[model samples]
Target chain A: MKKESISRIMSGIDDEYIKEAAAPVKKSGNIRRYITVAACIAVVIIAGIILSQADIISPSHFSSEGTTANESGGGDKKFPETATEGTAEAPLDSFITPGEEIDTELAIESVTRPKWEDMIIPMRYGEITLGEITYSSQCTEISSENILSKLGEAKMQGYDIYTDTYYTVTGEAYSVKSISTECAVAVRIDNGEEYFIYVNSWYEPEDLGDFISDLDLKNTVLFRKAFIDEYKHSDTASEHSQRVYADFDDKVIWDMLEDCLSAENTEYNHPYDRIGIETDMPLLGYKNISFCITPDGYIITNILNTQKCFFVGEQKFREFDEYLKNNVPYKEYNTVYELNPDGTIPGKGEDGQSTPGFNPDAPVQISPPYDPSQEEAMSNTQQSSSPEIPQDFIIEETTRTE
Target chain B: MDDSKIITLFFERSQNAVNELSEKYGRLCLQISVNILKNISDSEECVNDAYLALWNNIPPEVPDDLKTYLIKVVRNISLKRYHANTAVKRNSFYDAALSELEEVLTADVSSENEVLFKELSEKINTFLGGLSRENRTFFVCRYYYGDSIKAIAEKTGNTPHLVSVRLMRTREKLKEYLRKEELI
Candidate 1:
């Protein structure tokens, strides 16, 4: 057979294999929540950054590389064409026009803490610190119908299982799989009563850190980390869970977030399609934002409870994983599993009654002493619920043009 | 819109099915075309043609996965265009994938060998079935989808070098398997 026929022959492979190849691996519940919530924050910040950094488009870029829709046969136009040229030192707002600058700030500030009553906690990451429940209800819309309309022309509609929400998806859903093509998907969710829209795009996705850095929310933002591990009972072989909670230094969190956001799109398609319920629970956590650098090299955040996910490439995933493994300090709580395997220290059962699984005579596993402070913080913190959408984040057509 | 809804529209003879299908999968279809044709105008035209083909075919034939079906059609159309343009134009990405297969199945065959094509396809499927999930995904993504090594690496969360090495090994295995089956 001719070599060219091989392509055709390969197409007849089992449909199951094809489907398996196309679908991304399912993520765990906590990470899924992080992606959903954090996606909303990413949407607001990205849209705001796009507006503030609009001036990153130096006139020189327009003169040299700019092509109009008509010129490019109506192909997609990439935004912030000149953002790469901006140095880390230059704040993103520096690019804005004075009139537009004030307007953009007003839009952003409207979403900050305590202003709107239906305050949406865009991200509450960990159980340890309950990281600052940064509040915003600026993007919420009353009519479910209006939410779908805001997405421009939705080419497709999908359901997000985690939020129990339906979405109108605009843009190329498949481009998330391609590395060369710039991907942009505007996902609008209507939870039957209230709705919010977020645009998830990878236009120089690597610049997310720069955008976050520009906002300089690091100092004000609180981050919490949770390390969860599963241990096997030495005597009974029954598995139990252990959690270690710690706070991330704001700078470290910010730096890690930047590194993750700055990661180039690695042509991975982890299906930020409508968020789905993730069941496998991993033990590690980055911030109360429920941020997880998934093993498959994607960063997920449930900050806005949107369950939005994006690819951060493998290198970034490894770096984040390594940082969590080596640098972060954890005070383990619920250390009964670490004691003797000879049934001396009784294992806790589902009913909270001690099961006979511990062995005092067997080799003992040691863990760091439990810190009362971690438990105290967990008790003192009141977990925030999912927030309503921010109000002004919906970009006007003119805003994008400007 | 979901594939089932789109298919229902197609079954009902609604023109909106084409719009919904194009809206949802058009960008990806266009990307597939662009990868092979290497011309935006040509790619656009090829994708439009594929859409028309999809519209015509869906009523008579229901697809289990519209996205995959549409992609196969798009790739076929683009490959046809690529072959037609081979005299003057070259697409390194598409050619590289084709060349790898060419190296493995270098023996030329005529019309008489057409009967063996089905058996060869089945043998290949059996070979793929024996592979681990990761290796199977890597093979399909590379040879079947015509994805570049870098693209596969990014998608699979592996370095390009690792993807390339794995694909080479897989291809070697395929050659050996085919030889054992006496199909090549």
Candidate 2:
């Protein structure tokens, strides 16, 4: 990124967005109550101070009249005296633990998920047989409608489904496992073999997307193949592919592709090839080649090949996925305000442009634009006012444009 | 600028108040946000949000120190954003810092944040007042201004590591004071 672009990103903010995101500071009743309570305390403290100074009330007076006044006076009088001592010299030991130290060098460790519990199942491509398929008596036949219905159910339960491609094949099928929400069915055609198939209706698509997206396909080939195998069962494979392609959209798929291909576009002669696009593909000539609508119209994915890219390794991809998993979409509002170099809002001068380094709201005028003689005089005065003035102040004004 | 005049303008709720605040404290707020958020876009957003928050707040709440007020606003907003973005999957620096604070002030809903913040402000004020001119500047540079220890030491003619040690000790003292007050 250009330095100016980075600076702009750093400084460019939208005011309107902030205004919208900000919770309107309602006149907090609690704050008002606090102020009232503080006022009351202040009044009490001031009164006590005044009375003490006037010698109208003193500790000695309380000691002298104690027993007689204490007995005759109501419980309130006795309470205040006791509370006064209690309030005075309140023990600090209770609040401060000596062991509590702020380590200036303290670096917080990154959070991690439990290995076994959070691990994504690996995908494997291997041959399997029909007789080896353990059919759950309850295991239902696989079909496009069945898969779509299951996916729809998962979506209702907050899952997101993104199908990459679908190819069909007939084989002996096996029922591997069954859970409450869905069952895992393994398909095998030849003898003494098994092919894994994941069937889970309870898998929320949004969560599944996160889970699947995070998976390193090379390492989790078995798991990936399982999904691919099930997807192939549908007759409308082309239609489904189109839908998946459309669903991924340009932005989302590009972001995913960016994660997948850490190589910067600038680094390669053809970065599109790394992102699974055909190198000879006619679409490569565009300044920005974005992906949407697959061959079928089921889903969309974005594809972005940026000039500036950070090479995200496997670990980084995992970290990024973890970040996405934890973070939810938050409302963002932004508004732009012009700023002076010193970082204050800019206001128009007599000339209509903002007066450089001037703040209209400033109570005291800062260093005014200098006439040469006045500048010399101010410097002499500054020297007299503070002998600790730095040497930089004495430099000649060669750079001064005014 | 005259502090009183600035305070007066802020009370008046003039557009100039926003202008002056952004001019005087915009970089400071940006620096605070950047330090916390680490992402330029996010930090920039936080700074803008802080300015708006100050604009809304100053009329009703006349701050004694405008710089501190702006910094606090930026810090709070950036930290909130940080939490929202990273709370579920990954533990964030904000969470760690807050958890550390929770140790000082028990994390009871009633007595935690508001009471601790008020107490912290008081303690910081008292601490700043008690420091020698040089030490006060050093403390401000390291903590309030978030300058590095080496930079602070070089600016003040102290050793780099000495600056670090002094900051560490000061933080411990402040923590102790908070604990002693039973406000932690």
Candidate 3:
């Protein structure tokens, strides 16, 4: 019996058997395969659309080396036309485990992580000592100038300022994850209606610190006001700590509080952890607007009983007493700003005329060691419930062409 | 299940390892055998033999590629079966597969280089690597998988004539590649 030498060469089938195995199987029948083909086309189209809406998927690489790779005839195998000049990183080469064999090309493609580049959310991070007041200030969506300047001073004082694209960033009073690679921050935005991964790696992915700020922001007020503005807005009260509840309009306070939240798509549910009988709850949602303005002027829209004008003994305001009977977390009202508490309905003074607190000339300072209870609650309130960013900024497609 | 997980199951001496391996790669193994032998029952036996081979060899050789490892075993078993069967009756996809390459690749009766076949194989590999992905796939289906030209045509939605012509051109290319490499 003669031996065949070509059989030796045939043993090394360069075909991607692993890839073929990994591909979704379609063995129900021909009809199923046709449906799968249709479904795949739909997925590609949808991926293209949402891909355009955000900076995901590899970019449309224009190369001079475009060759017609369509084969004339043979078995059911397909290969993407891989341009050697393309900038899109191949999943195979981006990661390499330590001490793993580098020689074989056969088993490499299966282990690649889902594209890390897809998760980056371009965010500005800084190490600043502008005091705890900065948290509330930044929460108000005050101009970045105050923070930038303070950050600049902090930088001049030798603190590092980093601007990095994160898979995610969680801001309650401040960014929850200082390191983007540690874990994904699940942020709920669009009023807690959707979830998006804040760039994180449970596997400790490589940190590509791609940019550094050289701006001498020390001359700028970015640091001191990074969170809290150094300058008072025209809406501020001139009097010594004018009562914030009697001062700013409800909409103005709500909008200011709203500005700090990173817009996310997580569906917001009125977070109430009540274990009582279901019949005991009254309307269970959007009952009455309770208000507490933080010492630093951050408006807590729920009944805090801690602000300057803590109590308004109006009868009608007390009529909605059943809703406020249970001390549900105050932030739960964040979803119901439409039913704002009326100042006219809830009297502040016996001869209610106008409000105070807005002094254009005076800068508001919220001294720390104030409201430790609320601060503790803010820390414990799962960043999972908070918004990702103030608004969905149509982030430029980091990889793909829009 | 992951390849390492399956391998770990084997190391732990769990009987489930064989079940998982057979479940995952059974179709692939059967396809390789059926492509060569053309008999369903014979193909089934070949697949079982391939599994046994993998079950025995994996302790000594932990392959990075479980899928490829199984396919190689199935392919070798099927080839040995085909060669043994062909001495009596020259009937199978295996014969039809070798008949085409018999013209361009078979050793010349006049030539006497003992290492010529090994040299030819290395040269053929280099030659296939240089071809377009389509042409290389056709070559693999015919020689490696031992698929009939008509079956390849049906699968690829091409006429049998087109596949025949493509294969003929590829064989010509291989001859030239070997001659240029001085392996002929």
Candidate 4:
């Protein structure tokens, strides 16, 4: 492992192999080389000719109508009108005087207006619907008889059923807007006016009942409303809302979930009972879920099972167990522990804010009491007592040693 | 001595050009070829081919860095032989090595080869130092010895990709370290 040893070994490799392997490079004569070079040049010329022809043809496909209209229309529109269109009131202009007469009539006339007949049909905002949900290994199917019966009633009432995927809310910055035993919904608001909602559910073929029981639908709706209200006053709400949805679609949320699961080393269990996740602190409710990663840190999955649940949903939990067996690739371990056997949460305690008995190996210790004045006096004493060494002396000693 | 003079000597059917080239860069070419091919015969053939090619091409082509040019020729020849001998059964070890070089090339195309060679030399040393004793031994035996992926996997008790990924990550880390040092 020493530097010298490695260099020696690297240098000591035999020379005969290099000479023998390089023999073929000398055998290929000038005729073959010339032909290869000529072929390459011909290919380049042909490619250039084809590319130039393609470039000439490409411009015909794009129409100037849309571009010209957008540009001219944008230029002719008065600033005041556009400002009013964005919001009901005109934004205050620091540079312009309020009493200045603006030529609104000519500007209004130049801008094209929709015909009265064309305005008859009401415009509707597109609604993003929750589709089938899929679950990774971390999430489990929830089983609550009450939720199952409610789902059955809802289905009978003609509510369309869909699939869902579950992800733990690792950070408070992102939380689910709604939950059912079957799914959890997260909403993001854009520009205070638009809303993007993501509904996640466990998607094994057989465990529909358990999935339904896991979500607390009422809390989800509340969370969605709260999120919308928080963003309504901000200018970025609309953009942020779209970004949130895009984040989910782009698998950013899933990727973050995977990171959290691996880092936490806790099994991603199914959504907690409606009673558990429906609290005022939905963010905290997310932290209660567990995730575990494989030893080599590749695959992550949920480790908790039915026996771990202390509530009165045993029969419904059994249905979930059966469903998982029939639909999902489920593996059972001996027992799931709430805390790691090492007694420390995987990622906490670096800054010493961790709970007591958190880590057995390196328990976080309480800092000794501080007296600022005393510490300042001690620092002064130490500085005064210490002798400064000459830089030249230090250099001389180092050079001599080297 | 000038490369043209050596080439002129070779073209004049004098074996002195080969002798001069061997005297100048015999050890360096051997090191590079053996590093890749890990065979004595292959390395020797590559060096000889480099000399013969130098003799034939030197009238028109003049190399600025004779050592690098010769090493490159030897490396290419050795790799060709390695590929032909091993066929498509190549695994993570070769892939990792190529990927490391590719990553270096892609990240900085200007002065890539020089920067890569320097960084690689430094990084391999750093990586060896950073590893646990067992891992260090395993790494040397695999990379330095040109041991196959299966051999490395069995010895280190790790999956081949794990080893490959680790090596790839180490190379990236080295590049990063070199960047921090302003070496690349």
Candidate 5:
């Protein structure tokens, strides 16, 4: 009501007061001023020069030889400076654009967090008993058995979820400190006390030593510690330990990404390993792990918002099957060929070293998961002294173009 | 012509009274109209209509300040049009001004609070009268003229931040004044 009233005030009339004699209106006569002779002469001269140039200019100068009049960049000679907008059904009749740079759009539906009663279940880690081990959100709610089933299905589908263990030693930089939102849950016991139930050192086996200490969960560190300790030594630990190197600071990782993007502006070191983010696709502030690559080989690894892993050895980290296993939203068609001038991906290669040109045939040729990879890697490769282009990719691209 | 001459023309029922008013306040009325309406042709028509409205109301109305009366008339006319058209196509400039005030002054438009709008308007006018000349002009430029902060700064020759701060302080003062008036 106040807003409407105040707005009314902005529009309302002021009350009439007893008047003093009003001031009479001033000049009604038009006072015509002449243009200065010098100004007239200058205008005439400028107009003459403009008019003369219009006739002198050639049609060849206004060519659309190298410009993208439309986003398609179809190389149409008759391209207008303005966008060539048409119906969606309009086929590529005139121009053929270079490279596939289309991003798929999929609507994301948000749901409220799942009910605690349905989510609660008994679980044991070492001697510590858990009231519930699963975090049930509208998007993600899976029991341990469900998770195993998912991994098993992925394996049956030839997702290479297990063979990725081979490249675990080739690690770069990753945040082992954080756990996936799927693994984040609550532990409500029979004592009627609800304590914190978080991800133990399960993700980063290397950080298992201080995982319990880092949690500081309700002064029950000893109890959590015993449980974490047992998980660290279990068969899962031996199996997944090689992949999880624990130096990731969830708090400081974004700062690292900023540094990797704009390194010279600040004093922060550029991690040779790139954090390939969906510059366009921001899923609930979760930097949906697209894919990061070194220079030589490519791999589409894990897509956990919490775990940012390093593509240790190969530049083309080809673990797309692993990416498919995680039910995160991302478009498969939106790919770019990113070649860092420094020879390696942001954190994957050595510091500021000269890297080779893009190999269209190599795994790196295919692993650009998002748009920023083109921007970050292209900027890096553009400045580098040693930029190599493989003969095969050039021939292949040319053949396709023809 | 002087104020006495214009008032005399109004009293004598002369057609020159309308012409004189146009020469003196046509631009000013158009400015007030355009501030809210954001349409040139519509604003021009509104100003012309204000002159006609003035001609009809003058002998009985007997305004002390011609400038204020004209401003008030044009603002009211423009706002009527604004209310009518805002649902169809929103004027960002006028909407921005209203939203800025909306942050501090809120009435849910409930049946109980319907009259509160008019009361609040009266209180705001009283509050404006209490402010300094500079502060009053600053407040009016934003809420009345519906000018952008950058525009107010440019015209006032103050920095945009300074103009914004002054407007903020004035709104704060208005808030306190309204609270004391029990209109909040």
Candidate 6:
């Protein structure tokens, strides 16, 4: 078809559309712009304070036992032991300096590790079998098959379910955070005993890997290596050998929660939204702990509260997907909790110290009460509102039954 | 003045109706013409012709929306002028918008078939109704109004790159829709 015919046809579209498009674009006033800037600054400052309190930047946090390879009892792969005389290793340097005294302590102090390495939490490995997989939204259960079918129908009918005003998924168990045209997000949430797996069969594993990497799981969660021998005796031995698992440090998780809370002050929603997992592994300490990428290419998780809905754009999504596809930790791991021999968390006792000779298959304890101070902080952040702030997708507490 | 008042003036045969219409939507009308014709003199002439058409037509045919009716008149007149100018030497600006739409509307729509034209327009409108508010606005401003990427970016409060990328994606969706409808 000639281009002019198409243009002429476009001219005949509904008049309401033409009027709407022709309407003057609203411009923010100077005062409102200043307030937005001020609000963004306040959010950043508050985030910095909360993260500082959690010791996210301090290298001292990594110095704790079980964090380092040598301290964790790595035999052959252990770091080189320091000799009293700085012997053979320093022969070339020693000859160059001859009789000059070397400031060994200063030299050691000068060397530093990358900040992200310090963020990695060391963890032990194990597995937990999941029970039923349920799909839900707005605190009510929905047919997963039905939603998937409708999504396909919508695409075939030349309409988008993601853009549909009423098409929203918000819940605790397996909330559909993002419904992108290309893929969907299905996350697993364990309810203390059995796991409720919400698997999105349409989800591209490559995208899932990317979404998990975007969460920066390796930095925030403890990497654990499972005892392949133990799995060898069990029916799921091959599964264990093929997959890796990690336990997240609640401190980092809380930092992210606070970050999302502070996000309310910003005018525009930041593309990199935080994803929280909702798993109640006693080892996980918290009842909720997970995150997933939405079908709309946004990574959103409401593991903590439905009030935490945020969006990242397609470019950022693609970048994260590419990263996860390339990274080994994200590609190889399944994000399952590593259980101790007695089915208890190895370091779940007082001050994170292990309790010896625990009972196996004992009922897992529920998470402690939500910290009142944190709750108050979240409430305070949620209450802050401005006309300039567009997205206030705080799922009402009433909608969340659990 | 309200559209009703403007129409009442037109019905009463008052010349002030044209003046009121010009005052209310002159800039927008001129801009739409400029987008298509890309010539200030020709755009102004076409807008004036549209105002005369509105004045002559309003007494016999009272439009539900005066601004929308006036805009359509101006846009149609401007497009005619653009087509005429293209016969000699093409106006790249409006041609860019036409080419964009041409990507999806590949059906052989004969000019003689008014029914086919109306059908295509209705199908496009239905497709638009299903889009998100932002996507619909972006598509209309780009295709219908012949807006430049920078202009669309400014209107939507987004970067030019973002606006361009979104338009490209929307076009892809439109292509898919047309294929399903057997229009292309």
Order candidates by DockQ, high to low.
Answer: 6, 1, 5, 3, 4, 2
TM-score of chain B for predicted candidate 1: 0.91
Greater TM-score among 1 and 3 belongs to 1
lDDT of 1 by residue, B11-87 (tens): 99898988998899888787667766668899898899998898889789999888788888888888778767865
Candidate 5 CAPRI category:
incorrect
Q: How much TM-score does chain B earn in each model?
A: 0.91, 0.62, 0.86, 0.49, 0.84, 0.94
What fraction of the reference structure's interface contacts does model 2 contain? 0.00
- Share of native interface contacts present in candidate 5: 0.25
List, residue by residue over B1-184, the lDDT tens digit for candidate 4.
7765665676676878789888877876776556566666777887788777777776567665555467656655665565566543144243344533444333332323554445545555654454434334444544443445555566556556545544544445545665676554
TM-score of 4: 0.22
What is the C-alpha lDDT profile of model 3 across A63-109, one tens digit per residue?
Answer: 12212211122122222233112122232221322222222222233
Model 2 Cα lDDT, one tens digit per residue, A1-402: 221121122122223222221212222233433655688778767755664465533232112112211111212222222222112212111222333221111111212222211322111112222221222211222332222212111000100001111112233443322221222333332222333343332121112122222222222221100001011111211101110111112243345544433132112123121222211111111222332212111122221122222233445344433433233221111111323444434454445676554344433213444344675786466436433422211222111121
DockQ of each: 0.18, 0.01, 0.05, 0.02, 0.11, 0.37
TM-score of chain A of 5: 0.18
Worst 10 residues of 3 chain B by lDDT: B109-118
TM accuracy, model 2 = 0.26
Per-residue accuracy of model 6 over B10-64 as CA lDDT, tens digit each: 9999989989989999999998888888888999999999999987787799899
True contacts kept of 6: 0.71
Better model by lDDT: candidate 2 vs candidate 4: 2
User: Per-prediction TM-score, chain A only?
Assistant: 0.29, 0.14, 0.15, 0.15, 0.18, 0.19
Model 1, residue A328: what's the lDDT?
60
Clashes of each: 43, 68, 52, 56, 37, 14
Residues A320-369 of candidate 5 have per-residue lDDT tens digits of 22332232233222122333444344223474543454343553233333
State the lDDT at A136 in candidate 6: 22
Predicted candidate 1 versus true structure: per-residue lDDT over A248-298, tens digit per residue? 344654565654543432333444321111222111111244555565666
